[model samples]
Target: MRRLLQKVLDKSQKAPTQDAPGSTASEITPQVMDGVGTGSEAVDNTQAVGTNPIKISSVQRLGFQNASNSCSHRDLGFTGKIAGKWYAVFGDTLWCAPGVKDPAQDLPGFHGMVRDSVSLLTNDPLTVVDLNLNNDSPVKHQLQFVPFNPAWGETNMYGFGGTSLCETDARSGTGAVYYLVNANDAGLIGAGVAKVVVKSGTPTVTQRYDGTKGHWWDAKTTARYGDVAAYRDERSEYIYLLGHPPSTITGWLAASYVYMARVRATDAFDLTKYQYWWGRQQGWKTKVLNVFTPETAVMWGTGQGQISWNAYYGCYVFVHLAIGGGTVHLRTAPAPAGPWSGDVQVYTAAPIDGGLVYAGVAHPYLDASGKTLVVSFTNNNHIEVIKVAFTK
Candidate 1:
């Protein structure tokens, strides 16, 4: 516990004082609101999205939902290391749904409302936002659960799915944080961004939603490049972003194409500084208009997932979901830009209560050996964890 506390305090000191080269703090005004109240678990909305729930013996279940205080959330389980501690962030959370016992039905007032939350992870169980360390908030010492967007669940104008995070190169003391938030509805309002600044062991988070959203690479429309996963390249002074280009609709399953982009370590928030990977022939393109299209996707057939460097495989591993099917697929590349290997079926997700299982991602920080992985995906209204090991 002392080690965890030290890590949090250490991250506070490393917060950057300014945005990247082209971006400034005064550009977007922040809106600060109180934390969300706790409630009962929620059930899955009626959508025949993915395959039915099937338990596989090889895929070891970690039971993250059973261990946490807030067990009922549709979390992507996108994790990152903060102060050497692994933390998972959830997207659409249910505070108080009508029926807790019934898995098939969602009440009218409910329908799986979204309230984003974060979790602290251990081996067997995961801790939710209710950690009562020491704080003056109304939650009383608990880490506050703030919504990524206050208007997240509002009809078609401003409904959001969730966000993907990356440790930026811009650092002062040690740690730097940034999020590529995809905040849109069925009507296609598209995405935005949020910056999390830690100070003196406490965190200050801010979100911006408007016309000029999505910063550098992505646009504020469904037809633009939206960030799905991000990681800072240890070999280079840049952070590589894995984008899901919704415009490249090869099939009805989802965007079958993915793209790559990078920004300098110090200029993470400067969207204008981002450059897209245009393949080995063309290299990186500085102009957004000349960036990647469907023809230049880093990988195809999977639109959503996460990327991390795997020492075991000696490659950059991309673990993504079969959006239309209930399977988790993986690809490996020498660099973030590819010669990416073809899809390998790592795990098969079994959706509960006729729910669609998607958001297959790997927690790279949890795996010490690249051969064994800690993976997470959403089932119905909750998230589940599993272990996948590859033989040498």
Candidate 2:
């Protein structure tokens, strides 16, 4: 499986990128997910989102350079521990830091302290303490992030709406922020999930399921798309759900495959209780399909990848952005939908002013001895931040 991929990197000093050379597309989207500019424009929402001043400190002291072009990946990301520490719930908000230690004082969830649904309940600056976590502090307000329906078309009052989407896998479970949403439609014809909650702290969404004929891709299903990262596979009590397939509806996601479905981490939002990952009958099937099935590959896929669960090699990790290449791959799989493992490039930085680099993620709670993880990749309003060392 690509030698189980273990390329390390951690020079320990370069780490610093703020990407602001000229920025605009509302400044490369207030936080990320900044859309527009298609028809072979691919992405250039107005360029200038820079920040590769080149200082890594740890991508193994910075040596990878070789990116054999393996290609493979998906996200919003999901993790929740709060009070007990470890927190990071996706583009929706909650990246934490109350009394942290390493990773530079853990500084307001380390480099991406968020809260913006236009700053949730309102204190505004969101929250940040030191290593700049992107600046602006004070607005902590307990914890907030409630937007779910920009009336469905989502004109970015602050983010949410799927574009090149292929998501699923974002959870805090019963406590909320569940996830599995879609935005430009044509997911063959189906896909849905965006729970949110925040237990009293104002998070919202309530519940949404969308599976039966509101179009199950009109019964043709071949994994159209789900939230993009939902690992609750605690040895299979079942919670899987990762997905992809709907970029322009026929790009075939490079070579496609990395579709899955499951329910029962307490019915996970219900949608008839779901279950699909037949892999030609390897297991759970029967979700419909009578028609659309353009993607399926539990491996070698990447439209925008990220399926974390890499507790220092406990397995299941997949970070992506290697199709047109800026490097930044890394795959592994014991499950959570995968046979994965054939893309260990690790890190290579390149798209800052030329404009379009994308979603490569892997935060791993900002690394607490998980041998150092922190990966992030953007480039249109730039964001690059690598520190790899997944060693086992």
Candidate 3:
């Protein structure tokens, strides 16, 4: 894992000069909004002052069955909203419907890992779903996977690296890092394998020796697990990945850590070019600080972990996981890259799951007022949407 991290850190430094093959750098300008070129100003201008608490309406599910063949929505980790429409990315499926209240039946096509008894082990396909606001979709042109077991989140989505440790296809080995691109000009076929940029990284797909019930896959090659958040802030483009590494000596330890990486707009998607930071535990006091680049410390806590941001806040919210199973609390920062403040109870229930919250995605939206924030997660087979009301 150390070797893998070193390699990725090296690659991230070398920015890609080309957008794609034919696509020029001029075509892919930094994302802009409302006369402003950066996200921060636009977010501040749109914030709802003295706004009411956000109201959440249950939208329909993507209609996928579980391992038991019952109606189940598994691992709805990351979500994105483009052009007023909502999209949820889950394991093996990408679901799309009109609004938060649209019926599940209204959603079209299952994009990945179709169910079949004979091919149970071999057919698992990892997918990421998001609505394309730039284009119109009779069925909503969603991105699909060319490789199997693709690990994705609201921010970063990439193919699993290294070899597969599963007893099923241990022979094929873990695949390389690949990105999906438009297979056809119509944008109907979804994304297909175009290139393999990084090879032999960390986090092989394998069941750990300890009997953890779920798939304990790391987002990157490191010993961390959490969601990834990305957006352009104040002329700087940032990608934040919240990772919780295995804390116990044996395989059963429950403790976790969080870290982040940042890159300038000039940098490419390569992993080496960015700066990194790790969460530290110091004799009952925990601190989240940067490990690479100009060293800096951010937040310190005994509890806070999984972090997400609202462009409206101009900062990231550090969510504290309750001990012995309780409600999650939130803390805010001026930037996703932060010197974070203390905790504030944002929601009484677990943000991701009603029983056990796993992952969440927070995106800023505009309504009748100005900027209103909506946070969504897949909790116990149901996608719960919560409206966050900011206090002055």
lDDT against the true structure, per candidate, is: 0.50, 0.40, 0.29
Whichever of 1 and 2 has more lDDT, that candidate is 1
Query: Which residues of candidate 3, in runs, are more than 4 Å off?
Result: 1-72, 80-88, 92-146, 149-235, 246-254, 278-315, 318-328, 350-355, 367-371
lDDT of 2 by residue, 231-279 (tens): 5444556656556533333433232434566666556555555666533
**Model 1 residue 132 lDDT score:** 19
Q: Estimate each model's TM-score.
A: 0.68, 0.27, 0.42
Total colliding residue pairs, candidate 3 = 14
Instruction: List the candidate 1 regions with Cα displacement exceeding 4 Å.
Output: 1-58, 64-67, 97-115, 125-157, 169-186, 199-203, 207-226, 246-254, 289-294
The C-alpha stretches of model 2 lying farther than 4 A from their native spots are 1-43, 46-48, 60-189, 194-208, 211-248, 252-302, 306-319, 324-361, 367-392
**Ranking by TM-score, best first?**
1, 3, 2
TM-score of 2: 0.27
True-vs-predicted CA distance for residue 17, candidate 1, Å: 33
Please tell me which predicted candidate would have the highest TM-score against the true structure: 1
Cα deviation at 77, candidate 1, in Å, is 2.1
Q: How close is candidate 3 to the true structure, as a TM-score?
A: 0.42
